[model samples]
Target: MMTKKHLALSALLVAVLATTAVQFFPKTIQPAGITPPATAYRHSEETSSVEKPCSNEHPEWREAQMIEGVDIAPAPACEPDNPYEVATSVKGTNNVSMMTLMQTDLAQDALVMGEDVDKDGDPDEIHIKLEVVELNGSSPDGEFLINTYPIAPGIQPGLWVYAPKSRGMALKNFNSMVAIPMLRAPSPTIRVEQGDKVFITLENTHYLPHTIHLHGVDHAFHNSKGEDNDGTEEHAVFPGKSHTYEIQPRHAGTMLYHCHVQTAQHFMMGLHGIFVVEENHPNNWVQTFNVGAGQVRHPSVGVKNTYSQEYDLIYQSIDKKLSQIIQNATDPRLVAQRMSRDYNMTESFENYFLLNGHSFPYTLRDGIIAVNDNENIKLRIANVQRSAVAIHFHGHKATITAYDGVDQPEASRITRDVFDIAPAQRIDLQLSTQNNGVNSYGPGLWMFHDHVATGTTSDGMEPGGNMAILAYKPLLDENGMPTMHDDLLNEVFSKDYYAKKQALWAQGDFKHLLGDAGLIVPPYWQIILFGLAAGLLIGLALVFTLKRKQA
Candidate 1:
């Protein structure tokens, strides 16, 4: 009996699904770190597989084990390698498996802001040295200085992973700071406790060129004769180098480490990170290596305390007009103007979209966006950016159980909000407002953009670039940190508390409290003008209830 065109098509499909479940009701990757180790190192039979997201591939590497699908039912005369078993129709093209990761550079916040080396109580294995001088950062002054040392002196552009529950420590001499890493995105984090034993080390000291590809580690490559065993074009570490790469990640999840070179302008000139391997075990301690900041779910409550709760987002993006139109071409003519004058392979967005770098007073250094109950708890997300990232969490719904680092499928537990991710993609979202998620519309002060809509908005301004939120009353303080604390951390430690919030927000009288003004009115056309005024007030309440039932 509801026929005002089905009550204006059910109130315009519940107001366009309550504005896409009211902003995709929140949101949320693949690829575990990588895997491989050493005895004297450098030993590869080579491998590479694809059709094996969870099964069948070549030289074996979807993380050398733990695949749960593909009707696997063959090889088993008591073999001994069971990453979780599942390999039946073993196909051809030698599935995927490649490894050779070595990049280390930590100095901005130093892995979760914790680094207690030699003081006799954990946190110091981050020994750094990097060097790329001259661009204003300085250090050249003598015709390319040929030998200031560290031409990649074993490049470990910062990686101090630790996950103990089954063993996976990848520390290579943990240490940090020397200048010239530049990070900014959502970089700086290193929590662990899920099958630890992930040691890593690549002390290059920098000069230029770098290398660390564990993009989605699996180890083994080009074997059976040919060459190249995932050492990224055969291990690059120029400008004053060193090398130490190992992986024991028997697959536990959420991973990435950038710089595969020219790799989209070296991961957009800030390398990348967020290679967490934490799952907590039956009692384990000893984690200390800082640079981008994050680590210490436990280290004696982190020396005294620093992170009882946290969040790092870092989903980067900034075409700054394509890095100023590829800084006037010239990398072989910008690869021949990207293969003959930019042949639009999807133009790729830009004009700025950063979060941990600056975009809303540098997101106020991570704070301001609240609702109480601690902004609903746990959310790590990281895209690093190139393209593809659709988060949108207004009324909340994020339950993602991990991806790109694996873990999810305990019967798909949790309704999981929405997510799109692509480049580097790393998700850990557990976000909630609780019971059907709601702090009075996910309560207090929420938001967590991108779900497209021009990445929430930036170069076009309405909500200018890579937005932020979900902060609610005390996003973390008492030393646990973060509560709108950006300006690239006092502009990389020049400090002045962001020069007094830009001299009182440039005198704009608090301009909407600069929290990114989240609510949805950002170039999204106000949720299509509130779903066309909720479809003309449900078609005028079904034509006045059909003229009072035809009087």
Candidate 2:
């Protein structure tokens, strides 16, 4: 039998051994299949595509690609000899004949001509219809989403946006008997002449309630009936309900219109758009709505006076945690509760950034500024993200013409390479491709992107968010691809690039120097040797102590 002191020492050693063994095995904090099932779906609809007609039979119908609910038909071939003569329907003219816009509306849409009051050839009364649309949403059966708006490659965040009333399927190039509404993010840019009577009818088709708050626009606080005229949650239009707002803005400037219903949540869900008011000019039929900000197809006569091209640049950010909440539940109530109450905005961080409803590579498809030498381009930029963005332009320094739609004083107009835009702030920049050292470096492919480190990343991937290029016409190929590009399009264009699976610079010449050769994992022999060595040291110390005690 062991002595009492030996027994006590053995007990202590056993206690220590037990504690060490416990650390090797850990209990599961959360098990799989723990998420609760959805209760019910708000709406569901079956959507299917139709066959395309043969070009021989239907020569008029051009080949189309569906992008952000817009039909992207290829533009006509560039004729260097004759710059005026061209063929294309992608020019955003609504009713104006292609014959009329052979020269102008190549990148932008034409103003929707309305009945000119006072025989002035300009519209004084404007009526617009908007419907709430749910995009990339899930149903109880999870099959209702037809035209999904994917921000980044392989990512579709559930969104609710206000869209103009139009016939046909929501997505273009999709042939379907079902007349789905074309709902898209950064809702259609609404334009009206300054001091014109404007009526905006909001048709709430989604399950949740919404309201249109004319942000920074002139509107009455209350209507004649003492009802809330300013769009707010208190005066929200319920599901299947409709409300009309009347406003005649006194100023000519760029403004915002967004949902005021639980603004912290609903606004971020993509219920917002640019609202522009042009100075009243006779016969200046303005392009009333620019769905999906890019080129103003039918630019107002006023816009044509100063700038050759105008772009509405709306930048936004999304927190995946908040967007994923919509996918977690089918019940509209649960989604609303989770988004409006359960989710804490302060604790969340933005994971995605968008320019004109698309991330970097996709942004290049439409967001690029194609310019000629000495062309005056107007960029109406709005920062709707939570944080400020330092918009940096490579090879160009633009002059700030306006802020939040107000014209900057001539003396105060500043030319800068990077513009610091805060949340909900609008900045108008006059970009002149003059080749002057002060204005532009030269005719080449240059990048203009957000300088805020995180704003440039999509889910932490570089070259991924709100990044667009300013390409000189000579540098662009017939297909609009940059002729002289540093990057391999085939590599960056792949989904693997955004997915983080493909290693950066793996295909470069310096791959051997920078490639990620996987680090060696601890070998079984090494682990065993380490354990044995530690045990031997412990045993030796214990034996020495026991011998000393015994002596």
Candidate 3:
């Protein structure tokens, strides 16, 4: 009874109604392999506000209060006789007991693998457990907290680390600002003896997947029974999961370990650490790992005999735009979408440079390389930064001992003040502090910084980035902090200066020259103006040529 036109119109209306109904009652089905939304590892509420100051009065700052309380010296090694025994209450066992104690004891950052089941003096098997944690790092001035290096007072997302538990007082009870569990750079350095069976277990507590690829170190591609233990992208450990790597390093040298899953992103997110395999020397229970950065207490056989003191110097740069992706979203689903689908790495640029973990002034607070006159110090320097860096040690020359964990021949060992270190490159230098004409200019507060001009600034602010001093013992204060001239500590070097709130050059001060003005005109406008002028000139020339031809 309906006309063809009416019938068609009715059909269209029905289709539209059906589509609207479908929108109201959407399908519950999800695409295959899509991960469900998980809780964020670090919530916004967990981080401290930037405006609030970190409490120095907290018990953790007690050791740093006194000038001499800052212990720059290395913690003594645990005796081989009872390596697992931390205190009278804490005793490590072989079977699950050791693992249980490590988790319960706040003091245990690393588990001592000294179980000699064969009654041999040396440990037959070593087990280490590490957890990936999320935390906020306080800015140097205690003005704000961020997930990344707190060079500027902003909420930058970053990764934190938990070292292998040691048998001692729990870390929670340890009163030190550096020991506080928080996000930082340069993960704990894992030290092992050559020939000792080492088992490193990665406990993925973060929201994302991760794997530990032993970079440069000797490791097996596959473990017994054909399991994928290489810590590659194919064998990523998901959140709440665990993976153990079995490594019996044949050679002893400086090596690297980092998260291999989405390597470019994860590694830049601060998931890498130093791995050292020392020579098999008698009773050589090397300090299992150097968590964060400071003095290396347990030196390797090579370092202990050759140098009076050793320091692990890790250089890294941060691209804040890329790092902020993790902090932009609170939900795991949103984070995955932003990092994998939305973020573009091609446009990323490094804004903050770091030494050890902190920026310039902060680096001097803890990263001072204090040395006595004529003392030989070992500097195990690694360039974890993406860009190339030339480390110029002021007033001294360093003798190169090893390159990329390989010992250089004595004849080929180069002595240079400026060492060009590429990305992921490791250089072990013997810094001789002798006041000789050739070796060193003499004892003084020598500045050791990146030769790259931009490397000295934080977010384009001068005197902010990876600059620190090689202070002589006399220049160091009682707390092991370097004492700089008052001129250096003036308002110019203050946090507000780097934050760009304060002016570098005061008004009416002609002492400093103000640079030339940048281009005020828009680039497109200039291009259009140039095109118009060219067109007018060409028209005039053509008219002149035509008139001449006609005449």
Candidate 4:
């Protein structure tokens, strides 16, 4: 029933699709089995407790958690919006306030550390001022005044922690560049009590578009009346606008938030943060975490260590070539266009990755963990990406205790050199640097990285992004701990140099910054050759059919 023209068109499409299919076929890997000894693992015990320490009492177990590889560098304290801690005369003990944050190219994806106007141990109020300032020899000519307002308290403390949706960008000050939490988010934490109500208002101060979408925690989109509920399209905060999202996460677990509006770009630009809700009913304080790991030795009435230590290792891959597509957008008109455009999926990619916002060698938290003697730990890992990630370390096998924030004793625990991490997948793995069965391995420095070789690279450099180590060092007296923090190490371990370099590589140098668009596509010239041959054969067959028909 096919017409001659239709058949010919179909043949061409088939050839093109055939070539694509063969060229980009999916690759699969069978991960090695991680079956721990049946007797060694106590599935029946309500608590999985360990009896020995990392050093086995040999005297080296001085520190419970030691960071290897990266030198320790504590980021300097961010400047308060107001140098003089002025407290606003806000009434209620747990008062409520609201503010709108406008989106600007400068404020595009910066971390906001607004002034905590109320001085209630929380950034009671946040100010998001996004506007264009005239340059006077390189800096804003005048006092660039932006709106500052009080927003409602985030997730109540002692309950859950919710990651904010954006970052605050800083301006260059003379020869030095200062970091100002422009988005003005309070801090890296949120507070809550059990059964407490929560309200958050987001004012769109930015010119472009924006919205906040709670990742999990079963929030209602709209109330019975259908107003802008917790999770609804109507809740979107457009440019020069504002909106408040309210929710009560009765359930306890880690949650996330991102700009639902234009998620592809906004989320890629660091619009996501972790929301952890703690279980705090009557007669209960939040259980103490194992410090380094989110492990809880003494579970608070309704709490469990889960996997032990829970760290929200948010993985993001950036294509510097594309970052410039947004970062370098000088003109406001063009910047808005790029942000709103949905046709650039082809240019999207993962050239750089991040763990807690920094790479390895920069991850060592003072290069040590301080525990009483011995302890158990857990790592809450999440692969927040569309691509697959392979996580591997030089030492230790992780027993996965949970996935997607749910405890899973029934799920098989696999220990391997590499584990594939899928997009939006969270894996809770119980880890300990101390090797019980293996005696030869020393309790020292060991490296951990992504098994997928490509995930390790920054926008350009190899073996980059989210690389860190779990250092096991002996707990020493007070003298052993290096002055809590030092300034010299800060400069030495700085990743700013490499981070920018990788971005440059992704841009493909000045010569071909946007270079050939086909670069994103993997080359498979062999597939093209096969496709050509197939096309030739089809042509010959068609010619023969035509001759027969004519006869």
Best by TM-score: 2
What are the runs in model 3 whose C-alpha is more than 4 Å off?
1-110, 117-120, 137-157, 160-183, 490-494, 505-551
Query: What overall lDDT goes with each candidate model?
Result: 0.40, 0.67, 0.62, 0.40
Please provide, for model 1 over 1-551, each residue's C-alpha lDDT reduced to its tens digit, 9 standing for 90 to 100: 56667766767666675577447523210011111111111111112211111112222321223222222211111111122211210110012121110112222222221243334333323222222221111112221111111111111111111111111111212231232222223334444434333334344444445665667654445423353435473467664664444444455555766656446655664566665554433322323222233212223232224223434465676553333332233243453365335634256555456554445433433323333553334455677777888877666676676677777876774544468778777776656555443423534345567767777554444343555555444454432224454433332121111112122232233445754333222335555676677767766777788788988
Best-performing candidate as measured by lDDT: 2
For candidate 2, the TM-score is 0.74
How does residue 368 of candidate 2 score in lDDT? 73
Error of 2 at 419 (Å): 0.8
Choose 3 or 4, whichever is better by TM-score: 3
lDDT of 1: 0.40
Lowest-scoring 10 consecutive residues by lDDT in candidate 1?
A: 29-38
**What's the lDDT for residue 152 in model 2?**
51
Per-model TM-score on C-alpha atoms: 0.27, 0.74, 0.71, 0.53
Query: Per-candidate RMSD vs. true structure?
Result: 23.6, 9.4, 14.7, 18.5
Model 4 reaches what TM-score against the true structure? 0.53
lDDT of 2 at 86: 17
